[model samples]
Target: MSTIKAVRGTRDLLPPETELWNRVEGVARKVFERYGFGEIRTPLFETTELFVRGVGEETDVVSKEMYTWEDRARAASEKAQSLTLRPENTAGVVRAYIEHKMDAAGGLRKLFYIGPQFRRERPQRGRYRQFWQIGAEVLGPVSSGAESAVRDAEVLEMLASLLDELGVKGWRLEVNSVGSSTDRPRYVAALRAALEPVKDQMCEDNRRRAETNPLRVLDSKAPEDQEIINGLPKIADYLDEASKEHFAQVLKALDACGVAYHVNPRLVRGLDYYTRTTFEFTVPDGSGLGTQNALLGGGRYDGLSEMLGGPKAPGIGFAIGEDRLILILQEQAAEQAESKMDAYIAPVGVEQNAAALALARELRRDGLRVEVGDGSFRLKKSFEAADKVAKAVVILGEDEVASGNLKVKRFATGEQRDVSRTELGAYLHGDQ
Candidate 1:
């Protein structure tokens, strides 16, 4: 029989690495709570039509990258419904918000989620088919002050705090406004006219983007198109008076909060639902992410709920690419020091295995991380194994069991001591 392996673009998270992952998640949970965001977990997959409507048909996620399938039909009258492994979580969150009639409560709903998401994109370093995202959404009815520019600024400020708390250095915040939904169409139309002539001179992929979705032209990284793309109409120029003031207020709030940022006119992020204030957190230099330096990106979506057949609940959200964030952390810091179990119990004889277990159980019940070794192994062999995995090794032998005193060896200082059974608790906890 052949040994099977993980599917392409997917890999298992194991061991010491999962320690860092857990720490990262723990920090997120604590940090998000400070901002009054409660946890929300949606299904990993949803109906294909949900994404088609929420993520947008023009977006590459729906057009090229989704993992979709048809459900098995049970009856002749039943039609096979299409389902998809979520390429992103926002769509499903909003769907849940609508299904649960959250808007009827007439209050703000702040939800955060951390989980694996699926996409069939070409994988590379820090980019996988199955990746994790730490994301949150803040949405509510207009009467509840959800549409105010303060909400946008608060979200941005919260992200700045999150990155700082995580000890991410050299990070940069780039903010932009693609205008409101109404202002975007006018900008898109302007881009079409400008691209009609110069697009033929651009690359093949960009040429397609120019015709299908011109906002993506600004997002193109092709070197040759940079000159032409720069000369294209800026969204800032097309912004209506309301949108201009909304963006100004967002920036003003950031200024008051002492969160420094830059305005990048070309930063029209890769999503269709973004409007008003759009921003991305990036590490400009010294990041292991290379060309894909965006740690997270999001913006105000005043119309996304309505787009997905929900009520007019305006909101904003951001998703940190967990894989990329961890990569950056790993590169920025030295490898995490090896974690040591509290104690390893090494039995001196095969007959004393039960005794070692009893000792280990007592230590564990007292909340120590205890590892029990086989009694058959020689003391020297047991010592070597214990040294690798533990801070101390308990020498549980025949003499110690009868005398009610246990021998404990501290690996760090190469110190050994004898302690009565009652004193073992104090010794383990450093009270001795």
Candidate 2:
């Protein structure tokens, strides 16, 4: 027999820490609701084809990281479908959009979700094989204002507000435009031509990226290839008039709303579906695995619906790495101290156990947090246990039960007093 443990690349979140996670989620829900976003929950697994088509097939996520399997056919008449635990949520959300005919509603669908996602990559700090994400998407037909730059600005502004509401400070926003479908080919051609001469000097990954997807080579962070990658043709130069104007309007709206950002020419999303605006939020507080500080990333996908075999429903969305954001929040405040119970009831003897229970029930019913101790516990043992979990201890003895009065010991002030049972609830709950 073998002892069982949590799988590698996964760990359990225990008490006091899970409490912080709850607070973070509560704040996210409140903030998202203020933006008129409703919650949407897609399945944990979808047909493997969804991600292959939705997230670019050339991307590392599709080619390397997904957890996929061939579903068992129950009968000879059935087919064994390929299923995968979703590596990301955007594709599933879009699939739901098409299957449900959400576009026929003729209104924008603003949906948010918080759930677990799976990938097979090796886990390190803030990275996990099975991790959680908090994300949102706004999708609709062009007439519902999905193509407007204002929609892009609105989503960015909402993210800024969410981080602020979560007490995150010193975060930076990086923005860029990856060019539309019509403008991308010209840029790739120019990029391929420029890489031909210098391709031999680059790293293995960069060389492979150059031969396959040239835009992904720009995403490399290898220190040795920084200079060569920097000299590559900029995506900014390839944006047509429409893309340039659209990006300009997004920046203008951000400026009007007082959100600060830096435009990086090398920022690009290689998927053929990604178009116009793209952005990432990062914190430089030295809290994460260096340079892997991106808390969230998103962009406009104007043609994703079509790529996935749906109607033209343009959309923009962002997914926050919940584990990473929680890591940063932990560094900011360590453990957030939660309030303790107001009182603990210690029956002095086994005979008074019922009395202690009655008293605890009364206090609890009055909206007070009360803990009850075993009647068998000695006076010293009860006091020690009560002090750790509550601000005060109520000693319920036979004499107190008969006289309808009890001894109250206040831990903070080290004060002891006798109080009538009639006013016991008010006394324990009363501010000191």
Candidate 3:
């Protein structure tokens, strides 16, 4: 028989690593809840039209990276539908918002989600075809202040708080404004003209982007194209007065909250929906993410609701590259020791195995993490295994069971003690 393995670009998340993932999610939930955001889980797959309409059809995510298929009709009267695994989540979130008619109640909807997103791109380092994201979106009708610059700053400040709370150091915040829908066409026209002559001098990808989506050309990281990209028309120069004021207000609010940021004129971001403000947080090189160090990025999409066939709802959101975030944390904690269980129960003999199991159950019931060893193992082997997996080892023998006391040894301190059965839970719990 041949062995089957996980598909390329998809890998298993085993123990210890999953522990770190849990910690990150727990912290994210706490921080998001503190900001009045509730959890929202949308389906992993949606009608392909949802994305084609929400995320522009010309965007790389919708064009080249999507995992799409045509779902067959189950009945003669049923029609086939085009389905796609979500490459990004904001579109789905907005789809859900529109589907549920959430705006009918007339209030801002602050929702967060943590889950897997699929993108069929060349995987490398922290980039994967199947990756995890921790993201949030805030949207509502115009009357609810959802379009206010305060909302943008509040979201930015909340992200700053999350990174700091997670103990991530040396993160940089880059901000920019891509202007509103009315201003976008003008800028795209300007960008098109600017790229006409020099497009041939750029990389193949940039050349394609120049014709399809010139704004995406600014997102190119090809070193050979940097010189030409720098000379391209800045989006800031084309921004209308309304967009300029909106960006200024966002920056002012960030400053009032003591959140540091750098304004990058060319940071248009790679999303067609982004309008007014766009931002990204990045870590320094050598942070285990190599050259792909963007921790998260998002921007205001004032017309996303209407674009998705819903009422006029303005919104802002960001998606954290959780896999990259974990990589950075692991690099930072490289020297830290692995955590161990509270106690391991080692049976002195095969005859004491039953008794050891009973004791383990009791300890576990009282909230202690207990691991049990088989009585067949030799005492030395038991000690070695216990030392590796647990902070303390409890010796289970005929005499100890009969006397109602357990022989315990602390691996770290090498101290031995006799703990009564009634007090074993407290001792294992570090109450002693």
Candidate 4:
């Protein structure tokens, strides 16, 4: 019989590597919490209409990549409902915000989440069908100051801090204002006119986008289309005065906080809801991500709440591609010292197996990482196993168990010592 394998586009994350994942999540929790964000977990799937109404039907995530199916009803009277595995989390987050009426709480809802998100798009390096994202959202009623440029700047600053704390090197922040909902229509109109003249020369995707969602043409990554996209109308030129001021304030705060950024006029991210401010953090080539170098991207979506059938709530958020992030960390080859077992208890003989386990228990209870070896193993085999995973090996025998004295050998210097029962813990902790 053939063995079953992991599904395509998904793989298990084994140990040592999982240590890095844990580290990233641990740092994210610490950093986000310090900034007054609480953790949240939402369902992996939601009603298909939630995304259709929230992320927009025209966006590629909703139209092309979603993993959706009809969930059959249990009863004859019940109707089947279309459910989709979330392609992106922002829409679902806004849905949660609306359903819970978090606005009535009268304060900004600062929530962060770390979980897997599904998309059926073709998988590649750092991109997968089942992927992980570490993201946060800050939204609330207009009175909560959620729409302030300060909030935008603060979110950006917090991201900068997060990447720095994570040891991500040589990252660049690109910022732009796509203008507000009121201003976007005017810009989209201008973009449409500009595209009509040159749309035929662009790639097929951009040509279609020019008709369906002209703003997406600005986000094209085709090498042949760069010159054309560059020549297209810049969003900055069409920004209304309020949008210009809001963007200027965001930049000013970034500068004041020593967080650097470049103003890229063409950075109208792939989302339809982004208004006023859009930003992305990217790493240079050789970060193991090839052309897809974005560490994270998000923007100010002032109308997302109302778009999802909720009260007026403005928000800003970002989602870090955690798989891509770990790739970069691996490429950097950062020195992550393996966590060593503090002590390996090597039973001298089968008679001492119980004693060895009892000693291991005591050491473990004292907050030390202890491993116990089988008493049946030869001393040479025991030492070999201990040397690989532990900092020190403690020899346990009938004589030593009775005397409460043990022979401990340091793996590093080949140093050996006779440590008493009470002193073993301190000795393993490096007092020796």
Can you rank all candidates by TM-score, best first?
3, 4, 1, 2
- Candidate 4: residue 348 Cα off by (Å): 5.8
Q: What is the TM-score of each candidate against the true structure?
A: 0.84, 0.84, 0.88, 0.87
Candidate number with the higher lDDT (2 or 4)? 4
lDDT of 2 by residue, 61-159 (tens): 888899999999999999999999999999999999999999998999999999999988878889999999999999999999999999999999999
Strongest candidate by TM-score: 3
Model 1 / residue 296 / CA error / Å: 1.5
User: Residue 119 error for model 2, in Å?
Assistant: 0.9
Tell how far residue 41 is off in model 2, in angstroms.
Answer: 1.5
Q: Give the per-residue lDDT of model 3 (tens digit) for 1-432.
A: 989999999999997578778888999999999999999999999999999988999989999999999999999999999999989899999989999998998999999999999999998888889999999999999999999999999999999999998878889999999999989889999999999999999999999999999999988889999999999899888889999999999999999999999998888987778899999999998788877778899999999888888999999999999998988878877313334778999999999999998988988899887899999999999999998888899999989989998899998899999999999898877788
User: TM-score: which is higher, 1 or 4?
Assistant: 4
User: lDDT tens digits, residues 1-432, model 4?
Assistant: 999999999989987688789989999999998999998889999999988888889988888899999999999999999999988899989999988888998899999999999988888999989999999999999899999999999999999999999888999999999999999989989999999989999889998899888888887789999998888888888888999999999999999999999999988986778898899999998899988788899999999889888999999999999999999988886524334688999999999999898899999998888989999999999999999878899999888999999999988889998999999998987776
- Candidates' RMSD to native: 3.6, 3.9, 2.9, 3.1
Q: What are the per-residue Cα lDDT tens digits for candidate 1 across 82-143?
A: 99999999989999999999999899999999999999999988999999999999999999
Query: Where does candidate 2 have its weakest 10-residue lDDT segment?
Result: 332-341
Look at candidate 1 and tell me the lDDT of residue 373: 99
Q: Model 2 off-target regions past 4 Å? A: 270-272, 338-432
Q: What C-alpha lDDT do the candidate models reach, one value each? A: 0.90, 0.89, 0.91, 0.91
Q: Order the candidate numbers by lDDT, best to worst.
A: 3, 4, 1, 2
Q: Of models 1 and 2, which has the larger TM-score?
A: 1
